[model samples]
Target chain A: MLGTTFKRIIRAGVVGFFRNAFVSLATMLVMMITLFVIGSLLFMNAALESTLDQVKDKVDINAYFLTTASEEQVLEVKTAVEHLPEVMAVQYISREEALVIFKERHKDDQLTLQALEELDENPLGASLAIRAKDPSQYEIVADFLEGQMAVAEGEQQIIEKVNYHQNKVVIDRLSGLTASIETAGLAFTIFLTVASVMIIFNTIRLAIYTNRDEIEVMQLVGASNWFVRGPYIVEGVLYGFVAGLFTLFLFYPLSIYMSSATESFFGSFNSLVFYTSNFGMLFKYIVGSGVVLGAVSSFLAVRRYLGV
Target chain B: MSDSLIRFDKVSKFYNGGPAALDAVDLDVKHGEFVSIVGHSGAGKSTLLKMILAELYPSEGAVLIDMDDTQHLSKGEVTQLRRKIGTVFQNFRLIDSKTVYENIAFALEVAGMGDEEIEVDVPHVLGLVDLHDKAEHFPKELSGGEQQRVAIARAIVIQPSLLIADEPTGNLDPINTYEVVQILKKINDLGTTVVLTTHNKGVVDSVGGRVVTMDAGKIVRDDSGGQYML
Candidate 1:
């Protein structure tokens, strides 16, 4: 009996959905828009994360050493810097490598090449490039670098200069912007989710309202509450399922269009690649949300307005 | 009262502190009896039928259907109670989207009848209403008499012990009304207790059975094997 009733309810629901062709179309369209909002937010968040990572890569401290410092001394400082909690990595540039780089830059300038050849020894200093885990931690790394004392003389630092203070303002501002963007992104996602549910809910309510007389008749006919309500729940779920499929298709073209712009700006992040690679996860969330939202909205609208 | 299929005991209903729709009415309908309720507009005929269907509660006193008090039945119990009684409306409220066969099948479907049973029973009920050929047609395609016949088919498909038809022929022409009244008489002969209400004296007088007359929310006259007289 339970199985029979369930089958009848499902059949009725499907029939009901197609029965009111215009209302069903309006309902599915509204659901598509809602699901689209959610899916677009997923892609936008991926792009935003890629851009922030690219920005974070640009802020680091370059510490230059004196000409007297040995390669071993610089290598020792590099190991020490790597051991720091705040430091992410350290790259040691030898005096010869630095000279090679300088010559490469000045190769176009004949006067600079002549002046450089007149010197008997290489005058370029070895440098250690320090990167911190976070942009704001660069100041802490600078403090650690300024604390390094000279090995040969008192009050004479072996490190010639650290460029962290020069670019400190830019790094700080970038860090602040990244934080703000993350917070705002979360807030926007929540607000959009709430608004989308309500919009879809009202649309469903209106659709169900059109069937008020039918529902009353069904109730009057001694239909169990579930018998009356189950078909509509099925209709709601159909709207969600179809809309989810449409929204997924919508993302394909949208992601493809965004891929080039994202690749140019974020350097390595392609929207299409991200979308394809994460299709399973996206399908699980987007379609799942669509089905859940559709069912819940219909359930609530029926309960509150029609008293079913 | 214990043997009565439906009993209304001193039942009174008021709406929003207004005049009573049913005031201090006590009536009992026995098993397999065709009871016709006759009254003018505002005579509380529809309200009495609504109470029997458990659609409204009495402002005071009690209504019992086959031993279960209407006021105290649980939601599930109410559905079970209603399953024992069939209701018809003046409008012949058939589901417009459904075909004639499906409309009749709905009553059995709501009762959780299986598919094979529905397939067998829907055609039989259609034959009873003499609309078997139009089984697949939607309600909109049917005439007034045909629509009311479909409504009767839906009502009796459940095989309810008591059928409460509130003004079943209100919208029908004389010939169509005569056809509908004959169908009701046929249903009553098939051992279903039918309680009907109507303003048309000709339809009521034709029934020529027990007639209960109401006026100003009260039963002014009740005649056994009587005519429709206001």
Candidate 2:
């Protein structure tokens, strides 16, 4: 009997799906588009973060010490600033060494050599070149130095302006854009989920409407409401499952292809791997979500319109 | 010897505070008898039939099918009770989506009959309706009379103890109507109680069975060998 019921549900679902072919196709197209948009947005956000991290790896801030500062005081400040947890690295450059390095790098540049020869003495200060764990945290380190005891007093006085300003606005905009993308993606996902369900519900409701006469007949004949409704409910679930499978077939390949593109372009980014290599896992998630959406919407519509 | 298979004792049915659809109606249908309910439209024939099926609960008093008060039965049990009685509608109500074979087979399927039994029984019922050759045809492809027969096939397929047909031949011509009434009589002779509600006065006279007449939600007459008197 269970097997028979299964066959009947499958037969009915197939016929029902094909009976409303245009509408069913429209529903599938809408669902696929929604899933693709949301999926791509998530992938893009991840890629954006990965690319920003790569660029941030190249920039760092330098802190110079006063000639009057004791070596012990500079060492203490270095230790304290390093202990603040945001500092990635601090390389101390002495005044003579800083000047020698600058001259060596600029030796072939006639304009810079001429400028340096005009100076009687090297004006470059002894500095600590500091790399931060995140460029966004550079302000935090700078604030610690100016407000807290993280930097020694004489060294703090000798320190020139922090150079995180150029990247700060760009970093802030990226952060805001990431957040907005995530928020819009979340809202769009929810809206699309609801819309997909409503479409399925309306579709099933049409199927039910076409059979209202038969249902009324069944009811009159003392066929229990279950006897009347069981087949259609089974039919609804079948629609859900087929839609889910179709959704998986479409999105999983798209995910794989997009991930391949990301791999070629970005060179082994974690976001690409996280999004693409987990295609099967995400497909299962989507299929589960689609099935649940289809079934629940169908159930609600059946209960309300069919009233079975 | 009319041993009542169904009894309605002072049954009153009202709809949402309006006037009663069936008011203080007292009636009975005996076992192995073919009873036809005839009156003008709005004479409460359908409402009275619906009460027997427990589709509508009586606002007051009791409805008894085989001495069991249907008023107290839960909805689930009402369904079980309904399985014991078969109903046919004026529209034939054959499931158009199904073939003639499936239309007959569905009743037994819902009743949990084994597939082998359904396969055996569906053909037998279709043969009884004389539509075995058209078993693969959908309801829309059949004539009005054929569709009504399919409806009968589905109802009688379960062999219910009571068959309630509301306007079974409402859309049929005189010949087709006669055919359907003959089928109902034949099923009645097989010991199933038949409760038929119709507006066809000619059918009531020709069937020569008990006639229950109603007017404004009240039974005006119920007599053996009765005619279609209002």
Candidate 3:
């Protein structure tokens, strides 16, 4: 008995979905737009964060060591800085490497290259470049490095200078900009989801209104509430399921089409690659939200309008 | 235990504190009886039928279907009570999206009948209506008479203990009306208590059983042998 009731409701819903083709299509189209907007936000966030990462990569504290400091002393300082929770990485450029880099940078300036080659010995110090996970936490890494510089290493004063102060202003501004963008994106996504849910609810209410007589007839005939309401819920789920799948398909071509532009604009963040790689997560969200929105809106609309 | 399929005890139904839709009325419909309710518009024929269906509760007094008080039945109880009684309206009220066969099958489906039973019962009812050829056809494809017959088929397919026809033939022509009335008589003969409300004297005369006359929300007269009195 339970099995037959369930099958009948599902069949009725499937029949209703196809029989009312115009309304069903209109519903699916609107839901697709909602899912598409949400999916686009996911891609946009990826691109934005990647661009921010590029900016974060450019600003790090560089500590120059004294020329007399041995490689072992500098290596010890590198390991200590790497142990800091906030520090992402530390790179050591030896005196020879630093001199080579300086010469390469000034190769276009013949006078500077001559000046560099005329030195009695390489005056450049070995340096450590320290990067922090969060641009805002660069200050803590800087303070830690300063404390290391003060240790004196047996009164030799091996650390000559640290350049965090010069880069502090730029890092702080970058951090603030990224933070504001993320907060704003979250708020905008929330607002869009609420609006889409309202639109779906109203659209379904109209569908129920059109079927009001059928609903009344069903009720008057003594169909159990679930029997009367079940078909509508099934139709709602189908609307969401199909729309979610279609929206996913819609993104495939769109992601591929825009992959080149996004890659060039966001500097190696490809939309197509992100879409395929994250397809499982995206399906869970887009399809899941679609089903949730469709079923919930229909459920609520029938409750409010049908009163059954 | 009164052998009454429906018993309305001192029922008074007034809407918005205005004049009563049904005013302090009492009536009984016995088991296996074909009773036709005849009255002009506003005579409370519709309201009284609605009471039996539990669509409306009495403002005063009580309505009992098989000794179960309608006004006190919970929502699920109301539904269970409704399933025992089939209702047909002036409008055919067929789900247009469904075929004629599906329309009849829908009644049994809601009753939780198995598919094998539904498959057999739907075709039997379609054959009785002589719409076996039109089973796959949509309601819109059928004539007015055919649609009314389909409505009757849907109502009776559930084998409801009591069938209420509220102006079931209101939309049909003479030929279709005769066809529908004949079908109702056939269903009543098969032992399902039938309560029908109509404005047609021809329908009352044709039923040829019991007629209850109402005026201004009161039963003015009731007679056996289905005499139509206006």
Candidate 4:
């Protein structure tokens, strides 16, 4: 009986949907627009998150050491820095080596010659380029460098200076922007989704209002609530299903374009591959969520306006 | 005949801020009987029919169908009871989106009748209301009388034990009204109980039956052979 009820309702719903082609078409169009915009936003936000993560991976701290620091002391400091556990890689550059590389690389430029000659000696200190396992731990390396005392005979610093301050501000701003985008993206997604539901609900309500005579007659003739509600709920499900599939269709090409455009920056952006690779999972979530939302909107609208 | 196919046990229905729609109403409807409920508007004739169908539960008393108290029936069970009792409305509430055939088949579908049964039964019911040719016509395509006839076909399609028509002729012309009453009498002759509420005196006087007259939500008269008078 339950199975028959299900089949009957589905049949009636489909028939009812076709009976009022204009309203059903209007509902589908509304759903499509709403779902498409939301899907686009989701795709863009995910891409932004991916690119920001890659950018975060590239931020590092460059610490310049005192010029007079001995190679052995510097090696000891390097070993200690490595042992700090946050440090991923440490490259030690000597002052002479730094000068030689600078002169060799910029021999064609007069500014290079003037800047090198003004130093009077190898004014460049041995610098340790420090990369941490995590970008948030850049300050750990900075504080460690500033705290070293005996490397240069207590000249108020074992290192000349760290150039990461300006870079740090940029990275921090970038990170903050990314965080804000993520927060705003989430908020926008929620707000837009709710608005979409409201639109669909009011559309269904109008549809129901137009057919309220039928609803009241159904009630008068002793139709159950399920019987009365079944067709509209099915209408909502159809609206949602078509909308969701339309959204998927719109997302497909956009995801491809997004992936290709971002491939240069983030190495073959394969979100389409990733999202589609899990076809069963992703499709389940999308269709299930769409149908459920549509059905809920219909159920709520009918209950409020045309209770049996 | 059974004493009553429907019985009201001191049924009273109170609205939110006004006097009760039905004030300590006691009523009886016997099997194969055609009872006309006549009253001035707002005199609770509609409320009485609504109670029989269990649309509105009595505020202070109980209503019984076939001697079974309706108060304890679940919502689903009330629906089942309603399937046995058909209702026609003043507005001729035919589904606008559906064709006349679909509207008539709806009642049989509600009863979960087989399609084969519906195929055989729906056309017969429509023919009984003389609307068999307009099966493919939508409600909007039909005239008010034709729409009311579609409503009548829907009510009778399930072969319900009782039929309740509230101002069924309210929207019809004199000819259509006479035709509608003739159809109701035809259904009653087939041994189905018919309870009709109307203010049309000519209808009541022509199709002489039991008459229950009401005034101020109270039953003022009951006669086996009655007229439309308080």
Candidate 5:
């Protein structure tokens, strides 16, 4: 008995979908547009997060030691900074290693290489590169380095200078900008989601309203509320399913095209890989949200007319 | 009342403190009886039928159908009650989108009948209504009498115990009206209790069964074998 009822419900749903093809098509199109906007925002936010992470990785404070400072002293300072809870990583570079790295970096520049080769002995000082857990912690790490030099009052100062002075303003601005952008992105996504839900609700309500006569006839013929309601709910689910498929169709190719365009404009950052790697999870999210939106809207819309 | 298929005891229906649509009245319809309710436009004939079908609740009394109080049935139970009592409106109310065959089959489908049973039963009802040739035709393609026949076919396809026709031939000509009255008489003879509400004197006089005449929501006359007398 249940199976027969299910078959009839499916048949009725299909008939209803086709019987009101224009309204059904309008509903699907609106759903697709909403999903597309949501998908694009999600993808953009994910890409922005990754790019910010890369930028944060490059932010660090460099402390240069005096030429007279012993290698052991520099190493000791590196180890102390590394042990700090706020420090992410600390590396000590000797005077000789710095010169070698300088030469390698400027290998293609003849003027810089000539200037480096003309020096009789290495004038570069040993330095400690300190990275903090967050850009905001860089100031504390720099202060600690300066305090170490101050403690060496009677003897020569172990640390000459910290690069935090040069980079502090830029770092502070970048962190603040990223933080606000993230908060704004989250707020915009939420607003869009709520608007999408309301639009879907109104659309479904209108569709049901157009079919009010049919519903009245069904009730008069002694159709159970569920028997009349089941088919419309099924129709709603189908709208969601089809909208989801269309979103996927439009999203993948658009992501690929945008990825390539961004890579060319921004120099070799392949943003497309993020989409490809997470395609399965994203697909599930879009389809699941569509189904939920469709089902919920239709249920509410049909309930108002089922008072009989 | 114990043997009655439908009983309305002291029934009254008021709308927003205005005059009653159905005044305090007591009536009984026994099993397998053909009862025609005749009245003018606002005599509450339709409201009485609505009460029996559980579409409207009496304001001051109880309506019982098959010994079950309609006012107390759950939503599901109300549907079950309506399934046993098929209703036909003056407008025919055939689903315009459906063919004659599909229109009748829909009633069986609503009753949860299987496709094979519907396939067999729909054709039989269509043949009974003499619309076998118009099986695949939509309601708009049929004449007024033919459309009423389709509505009748839909009502009886599920084999309801009670058939209520509210001016079934309201839109039909004299010939069509006569044909529809004959169909109702034939259906009543087949052991289904029929309640018909109409203002047409010719329709009431032709049935010649038990007639209940009403005026201003009150039944003024009731006869075992009566004609249409206002």
Candidate 6:
């Protein structure tokens, strides 16, 4: 019995949807626009988060050692720093490797190469590069390195200087900016979602209003509230289903176009890979939200008229 | 009271403290009886029908369908009650989008009849109304009488125990009116209690059944085997 009722409800919904094609299409278009705005915001936030992570990964405190410092001494400091919970990684760069990198970086600068060759001995110092798990933790790591330098014996202060001071201001500003952007993006998305819900509610209400005569007839014919409401809720879900499909159709190409358009800025950061890996979750969210939005709006819209 | 299908006990309906749409009135309709309610435009004939259908609640008294007071019925129960009573309006309120066959089938569908039954019963009812040839035609394409027939077909498709026709022949010509009255008489003979409300003396004279006349929300006259006498 329930199955038959469900079939009838589905049939009614399908008939109503097609019976008023213009209104149904208008509703679907509105839903699609809502989904599109939400999808774009989500994708933008994801790309922004990925880009910020890459930038943060590049930020670390570099500690230079005096030429007199032995390789074993630098390795000992690297191990000590590695033991700190804040330290994500510590890499020791020898003077020879630093010189090779410097030469490669400035290979096109003949003047710089001549100046480098004019030196009698390698003036470059071995350094330890310390990466912290969080940008805020960099200060603690820097303080640890400073204490190590200060406590060194008077005749052999092997640790030269840590570049934390030079990098601190920029890292702190970037972290603060990213935090604010994330907060603001979340607020904006929520605002858009609420506004979209209202629009959908109104659209469904208008659709029901257009069918008021039909609803009256149904009521007079002894259709129960469920019987009258079932078709509209089904229509709402249909709107959502179609809107979800449209969002996916529009999102895929839009994402690709955006990925390429911003390649010069974000290409080296592997933003495309980030989207591809998380595509499944994104797909589920967009489609699920569409269906939920459609169904909820429809249910609320038709509730008042069902009193008949 | 035991055999009554519908009973109005001191029923009164008022709208916003104005004059009553239905005054304190008492009436009973027994099972398988043909009752005609005749009155002028504002005589509360429609309101009286609505009370029986549970579309309107009494302001002062109780309306009972099969001895069950409608004032106490739940919304679900009210719908259930309505399913057993078929109602036809003057405007021939057929779903404009549906064809004749679909219009009748919709009533059966609302009663939760299965597809096979609807397929069989719809054609049977359409044949009874003699609209078998216009099964697929929309309401707009049909004449006024044809439209009323479709409405009648929709109302009776569920084989409701009670059929209420409010001005069913209002838009029909003399020939069409006579045909509709004959159909109502035939349906009454088939053991469905029919409550017809009309101001047409010809309709009341033709039915020649129990007639109740109302004036200003009160039943001023009721006669058995009577004609329309305002």
Q: What RMSD, rounded to one decimal, does every model reach?
A: 2.6, 4.7, 2.1, 4.5, 3.0, 2.9
The true-structure Cα RMSD of candidate 2 reads 4.7
Off by over 4 Å in 6: A68-73, A83-87, A103-123, A150-158, A252-259, A268-279
> Between which residue pairs do clashes occur in model 2?
none
Q: A234-276 in candidate 6: lDDT tens per residue?
A: 9888888888888877876665766766667764433455457
**How many steric clashes does model 3 contain?**
1
Q: What's each prediction's TM-score?
A: 0.92, 0.81, 0.94, 0.83, 0.90, 0.90
Please report, as a residue range, the 10-residue window in candidate 2 chain B with the lowest summed lDDT.
Answer: B103-112
For candidate 3, write residues B17-135 as lDDT tens digits: 98998988998889999999999999999999989988889999999999999978999888888888888888888987789988888888777888899889999999999999999
lDDT by residue for model 6 (B1-230), tens: 69999899999999999999888999999999999999899889989998888888999999999989998999889988988988888999888877788888888887889899998999999999999999999999999999999999999999999999999999989999999999999999999999999878999999999999999999999899988887
TM-score of chain A of each: 0.87, 0.62, 0.93, 0.71, 0.84, 0.85
Tens digit per residue, CA lDDT, model 2, B83-188: 7887788988877777888878778876767889998999998888898999999888999999999989899999999998999999999999999998998898
Instruction: Please rank every candidate by TM-score, starting with the best.
Output: 3, 1, 6, 5, 4, 2
Residue A59 CA displacement from its true place in model 3, Å = 1.9
- lDDT tens digits by residue: candidate 4, A1-308: 56766777888899988877888888777777776666655555656767767776678777777777777767777888888978888888877788888888888999979977886678767878888866667788778876774345544455677876868887678667767877988898888878876776777777777777678778777777888899889988987887788767666776677666666656634667655765565456456656877898888878865653
Candidate 5 lDDT score at position A168: 92
Top-TM-score structure, candidate number: 3
| Candidate 6: residue A139 lDDT (0-100) | 91
lDDT of 5 by residue, A123-174 (tens): 7899998888888888889888888879645777778888898999988997
- How would you encode candidate 2's per-residue C-alpha lDDT over A1-308 as one tens digit per residue? 76776575566556656755665666555555544544554565556657656666656666666665555666776787888888988877777888899989998899998988899977776667677886667888777665543455554454554445665676566556656755876786677656655665676677567667777766655566555666666555555556656765665566566766776676546443564576676666665655665566556655664432
lDDT of 1 by residue, B128-202 (tens): 889999999999999988999999999998999999899999999999899889989999999999999999899
Clashing pairs in 6: none
**Residue B53 in candidate 1, Cα distance off native in Å:** 1.8
Per-model DockQ against the true two-chain complex: 0.63, 0.54, 0.70, 0.58, 0.67, 0.66
The 0-to-1 C-alpha lDDT of every candidate, in the order given, reads 0.88, 0.74, 0.89, 0.81, 0.87, 0.87
**Candidate 1 deviant stretches above 4 angstroms:** A67-86, A113-122, A147-156, A305-308
Q: Pick the candidate with the highest DockQ.
A: 3
